[model samples]
Target chain A: MSETAAPLAAPLFDRVAIVGVGLIGSSLARALTHYGVARQVVCADRSPEHCAKAMELGIVERATTDLAEALEGADLVVLATPVGAFAEVGEQLGPLLRPGMIVTDVGSVKQAVLRDVGPHIPDGVHLIPGHPVAGTEHSGPEAGFATLFQGRWCIVTPPPGANEGAVDKVVTMWRRIGSTVELMDANHHDRVLAITSHLPHLIAYTIVGTASDLEDDTKSEVIKFSAGGFRDFTRIAASDPVMWRDVFLNNREAVLEILQRFTEDLTALQRAIRWGEGEQLQDHFTKTRAIRRGIIDAKQA
Target chain B: MSETAAPLAAPLFDRVAIVGVGLIGSSLARALTHYGVARQVVCADRSPEHCAKAMELGIVERATTDLAEALEGADLVVLATPVGAFAEVGEQLGPLLRPGMIVTDVGSVKQAVLRDVGPHIPDGVHLIPGHPVAGTEHSGPEAGFATLFQGRWCIVTPPPGANEGAVDKVVTMWRRIGSTVELMDANHHDRVLAITSHLPHLIAYTIVGTASDLEDDTKSEVIKFSAGGFRDFTRIAASDPVMWRDVFLNNREAVLEILQRFTEDLTALQRAIRWGEGEQLQDHFTKTRAIRRGIIDAKQA
Candidate 1:
């Protein structure tokens, strides 16, 4: 069924407040307005420059540095700031929230959303934590495009006993904005992303750091010859540092668990290379090829 | 200076033989013909199916499994096979080679080319190891395209006292095919590529394998939500397994050295994440971002 089959006259949310105008937040605002899901979009960002850029881009009807002003008269409030700032933002937002308002988020780590922001939610408010599994290495309001979420997955991990109507509304909004929505447990979401997202970013950052520390002559050569494979890691490593810092800190246990497995796997391959075990290296390399094919077949590649 | 400004009317070689009708070989063959660089192109492959595909695609004038037959009347012979097979292939071709023929290769590792194939070169024959730093995740002759090397670097590592005339001819041929050529020491080339290319591939293969070995239910979710960062690694891991297997095996010392540094760096980041040291994580991530900017400014991004 088409989630956007609603008539053109209908606006899913009369007033939607986006409480961070960075890449994900700006992109969400653009998508919501482009899909006619929100009659009015207001964004709050700590950076005055980002707020002004969002306004100039016309992604929202209003932009401000005041979190309370942005939340005024908004039935849907999205906490799109970095996860590290969620607890403080939650404290400031609690007094501004009204009964029946729905609160959601775009943090990478899901469980942290509940731990940081859940207590501040009003008794009658609905809390549904979400993660839009899509982005480029680029960040900021200008880096965001309206089509960033197209054909991507948006995972929603609503807290237990979340109002069904609020969850359905959020799902419909995401679907209308061109994401396939998946409902998952918060802890399970963290585990899966630890492998799929967090671990990969960690590896990319490490390798890029290694390259940067090379002798000056060798460093230039690395950049010139990077098209071989290093360039891909550089792009991943270019992702927003503050956001990733928060992700690693908030999802420490899962990320560390996966990192340990990755380190062990890497050590075995290292040993294979050290011992001239061509068959072992080839066998492991060959097995990984099938996973790539699976991802391509799933339209995720 | 503009490399391709040379008039297209001049053919760089009378006849060229490309050993191994795979992605790199076929693309070089197509570029030779597309730019009128070779009067005739011949290809040799162990796979009859690939030979047939090369012939049907018109990328080569002749295709055969017999290396000697393919090299007949060819002034330029390019060994484009996996590095592990070079010693045997070199032994076979050494008897068939005539004096003054320029033998170049597109191997990822340079020192290995000299070690495995150096002794096989006949007196007066030129052996210049060339690595064109470009490729997609795809492989095989059908995956080859004429524009693969355009604007990419082709590093040529020639042995001491190599014939200057032969080196100039090979450099001119690569230029005609739209590559910026750089001359470097073979040992240095291996070390640079070890960090820029080999280590990244090793890391990618390990991470992809880690994700693949997860519990089946979580594995599917990892693939489904991979756009976050893992998808990029999967693309790199999807690269030809046999080709990469030989790379790690042939360039063992350099690859291991770089891998050691990478492991230490990763462990540092892992510790920071485990201890919730957001500043340390943020600082390292912030430093890596500069390398990406350098790649972009260099037009390699």
Candidate 2:
């Protein structure tokens, strides 16, 4: 991630296994090896092609389609698949988990991870859910790199009364990969991300969809002149459809609540424009600039 | 500008005057000098501070508060003020324009430029309205650079029965300054840009405005976790308020029309999410990805 990270003195885990070796999963695998955070990093993916690509790219020491084989002797198991696959994957992964093993995930919606995978986790195995707020529009194993988590925030949501040691290890691993770690409740994390991540994506998808439905001539011009602003939305809308679908389906309540608020604000602005209320529009835009300034000061800009 | 552009054989215009030296205006001034497209670049601004800043930055050869002073004997006059000021500027500019002088503008909405500035142009003066599909969120003279329009499209909307020689000169100047020129009707240009530029800015401003209205605790979290997606909207929403305000006010019809379509599509997607229609969401998201590819292929991404 950051060029200034100090070299790791020792591996944090003896054996680490990542499921669904796509963008985030493969990036984690690369980061673990690149930073020497794991003695051995392996991955299991539903797509054999991704497993082959991960190994071919030397991102992981071992790659396989079989969940049990990949999880064998893994002290740390990361479920990096889409949230929709968690229940089925969790059912198969439960018996494979050994006592003292720590299981975590990097899904967008954290509460769903708890609802889908929490019950399937055996009593002795730790199930700590985490979401790293970092990724590109690209997906699949080849799209990942070692520094994807560098300078990014990783929110780890450990269940109530969970093992402190297990939570600490997960936090430490993220830190070793150059991420700042924050711990929050699963419900709160979902609410925050619905506004910060999910709603932006949904709006982007909707706008891009609107453009695509325009008359052919206008649609082509939209693509031609997209450098103005629409191109940014296109990039966001280009993100993995399956992953985003699961994000919307799983985090319905929070996303919809925030989306309603967004709609109300939009309608107010639309009214301002219709009525030629320049002062109101300018004031709203002016205040938002302060938030951008705050974000820059926070180093998130 | 692309590294492949050939050195200019000679200056395209002598004594170029740019009114309202803000972000796009200052950049154009810089580009005219950097590419040796103008023999001398001068700017006029209502704000004395901006005029001084432009001179301090060496973006213009001469900067003045009086539009007439800046346009003195200039062969080319570029109206670079916000569209909202075009009518007032045009009223003042009408008598000062010399015969055979080519007048153009760099506004976001084309029809508004024609409506506001068109009638004031006298006989023998060419009125060509243009919109450069480029810019950053930054504003003011200091925020501009010579390459802002490089590899971007410049839509030139010349009225019927306009002088061909004047049109060619305007198009040539844009090409010399590192832009691809496309000629179209003013009405069509407004509609194209309504979807491509104005609508995106409106949505971004709306969403960032929504985030700004959140409670303090959640607001801080929005900034903290902004990297997920909201950060991009913040960046877009950080654009100059007055300029964007003018954009929405002038381009109301097209912007509102496209906005209605966007809201309708969003409602459909919202319903699909509420109903747990994963297939519909995935299919819609998947199709939008193709438009991103189209942008990338157009070399506009």
Candidate 3:
């Protein structure tokens, strides 16, 4: 047992398969290989162009369109695809997984992953869902870098009674790639992310869309003057449409709940503006400033 | 006359008084002194600490809490105070201004600046309301830098039939300090900024405020996991509370108009999310991506 543990402590996986080669997937591929955590990194992307780019970028040792082909001899399979496709992908991936293999995902919404991918895990295969709370507005294979996950938080949501070794291995990989790992319940992950990620993206998308529909002259001016704050929203709104759509759809309950709270707060502020209630407006704005200080103190700003 | 023309083409003002010595005010003071556009930069701020800091920082040659004292011997008076304070400041400075003195402002809301400061302008004084569409989230006198206005757009809205020489001097000063000056109507400036600046700030303040009110455990987690999106909002919402509160109050009509549109659009998106309209959300998200590309192409990103 000690002899077997020696190699297990070395490279975590001999062959690792990333099932999607987008921003997060490509970043992981580069990081795993750069850290020597995976001996061989393979990519399976539905987009042939992404697969080609992944290979050309040298982030993956091999690229394939077939999930089964990518899974062959792989000890770890990472579902990096959109959350909406997770259930279907899990259905296809269950039959191909080996008993000792581990299946992990990089979805933003965690609860949906448990509901969608939990049933498909084979009797002996371990499943751990995670979200690395980091991203730029850019997407696609070429947009990723090896250091993308550095200093970021990666939350791992492991189902009850799951293999302890499997959970530790996944956590070790994230930490090796320079992420601070946190073990959280899937439900709590979804709720927290709804406020932090999902609601912000939704608001960004809404505001940008509203600005885009302005008169042609006004639209041009909006772009010209965007440094005023709208520019930041535009960058957030520019994130991958399909990915964000899946995030909102998959985490509807938490997102909608938080969003309802947001709408009420916004309405109160709006009324304050209409009534020229300077005190009310100033009070709210003052309270929000403390949060930014907290974020700076926490070293997240 | 030729000898006078030589220096006339040199420093624009013999004594420039900057009221309110805050971020924009202090930055302009630095720029004016750095570019030798003003012979002496004097500051008048309600906050004695800011006045002392402005003088200590060497952005101003002298600082005073007395507006009349600072404006003495000043040929140019820049109202750098919040719009909410503009009317009161203007009323006090109106009788003290000498003939040929130019009165300009760096207010966010142009129409309100004109409405408040216009009536107080003496016959020889020029009231050219301007908004330099640039700033960082930081505030106060020390936060100002010489290059704050570099490559940014400055919209100058001179009331109809205003003094051409006054307008030209203000425009030339901005251009010398590296701003691209554009002549726009005060109404148009207010409307455009409502979408680009005011609404975005309001939304950011609301979202960050919402997150700040979360349960202590979740609030800490939100900060820890902020790289997802909430961090951007926090930065914007961290802006000076009094300045933003005044902006919303002064430009209530225009801000309310754009905000009404934004709310309706947000509601539509919210309904889409409720019904799981993935395609609709995706389409809106994709369209907004084009706006970011437009901003990049415009070199405003």
Candidate 4:
């Protein structure tokens, strides 16, 4: 018992199987290995190219297309695929998850993970859903880096009555890889991220879509002058399309709720602009500065 | 005349007067002096604090709160104040202009600048309105840098039948300070910026306002987890409130037009999310990525 307790204190997973090898998955594999959080980090991606790239990039010790093959001997499994793929992946993944193994995910929307992956988890296999609130516009295995999770917040949504040791181990891995972990309820996590991530991405996508449909000459000028502010939206809008789509679909209620609030607020400002309400516009704009200050103070900026 | 040719070839402004002495104003002063584009740089601001900072930073050879005092012996003048102040400042500025002096602006909206400042221009004085499609969220004189305009586009909209030599001098100044000059009409410049700059800013401000209004608990979490995407919007929304407020009031028509289109697009996306149209959302998201690629390829990213 003491010998077993000693290994648990180190919080090292003997094997970690990351199923995706895309940006987040590949980055996690790199971080787990680079930080010595796992004895071995293997990945299974549906795309052969991603598997090849993962191995070439040396982010994972071994990369394969076979999910079962990757799961063999793994004590921890991480689903890094888009949320839309979770149900199918979990259907196959549940049977393969060993009783003592821990299954977690890196999807942006959390409640959907619980809804999609919860039933598949074997009774003894612990399930924890998480979102590492960090990313770049770039994607795929080659874009992954060992320090991708450094100084970011990783929110974990563990099932009610789940194994405490399993939850602690998952949190430990994230912290070890340079993430701050926050334990949260899946529903609350989805709601928080809806405002923080989903709504922002949806707005970015909408504005960019509108800009792209402009006349050819106007379009070129728009691209040329984008540095003013549009460039930032473009970068955010350029994030993984499938991933973002899944996020909006899975987090529909919370996203739609926040977006409805956003539209109402936008309409008020629009009316103010049309009516030449300068002071009103100024007051509203001034209020937002405090939020940015809070973010900077929180060191998230 | 041949002796004056040497100075003209240098593309230098002698005794330049910059109004406002804020972010864009101070940055222009720094660039003018740092790149030897101006023989002497002086600035005037309504706030004496900004003038003091401008002089303390050595960004200008002279700084004063008196616009008339700053314009003495100046061959060139730049109206860097917010567009809302253009008419009032132009009234004060028009009488101070000399016959040979060329006046330009670094305002975001060009047509409004032309309208507000154009009527006040004395005969033989060139009024070439310009917009350097660049800035940070930071404001005030001290938040500026010499290279703020470097590798950026400075769109100049010279009035019809404008003085060729004066236009050339303004264009040359922008080029010498490391901006690529695009000669555009004021109407077109305003329309283009309506989408690229104004609408994006309005959306950012609105979203940040919405997020800021969330219940205090969720508001704190939003800021803490903002790195996902909200942080970018906050940075943009953190821009000077008065300046942005003035922009919306001045560029009302163009901004409202683009904003109408943006709202329609956002509604379509909202409907798509409601109906769980994954493919539609994915396609829309994918198309926006092309615009980002265009921006990157154009090196405006």
Compose the digit string of candidate 1's lDDT tens values, residues A1-301: 2355345637789999999989999999998888888999999999999999998999999999999899989999999898999999999999999999999999999999999999998889999999999888889999988888888889999988888999998998888888889999999999999988899899999999999999999999899888888998999999999999999999999999998899899999999999999999889988998999999999877
Off by over 4 Å in 3: A1-9, B1-9
Quality of model 1 by C-alpha lDDT: 0.91
Compose the digit string of candidate 4's lDDT tens values, residues B167-272. Answer: 8888888888888899999899889989988898999999999988989999999998998888999999999999999999988999999999999999999999
Error of 4 at B150 (Å): 1.9
From the highest DockQ down, the ranking of the candidates is 3, 4, 2, 1
* lDDT tens per residue, model 4, A161-278: 9899989999988988889999999999999989888898999999999999999999998998898889999999999999999999999999999999999999999999999999
Q: What docking tier does model 4 reach?
A: high
Worst 10 residues of 3 chain B by lDDT: B1-10
Q: Model 1 clash pairs?
A: none
Task: Considering the two chains of model 2, state its CAPRI-style docking category.
Answer: high
Note the DockQ of each predicted structure.
0.82, 0.83, 0.85, 0.84
Question: Candidate 3 or 4, higher lDDT?
Answer: 3
Clashes of 1: 0
Of models 1 and 4, which has the larger lDDT?
1
In order, candidate lDDTs are 0.91, 0.92, 0.91, 0.90
Error of 3 at A110 (Å): 0.6
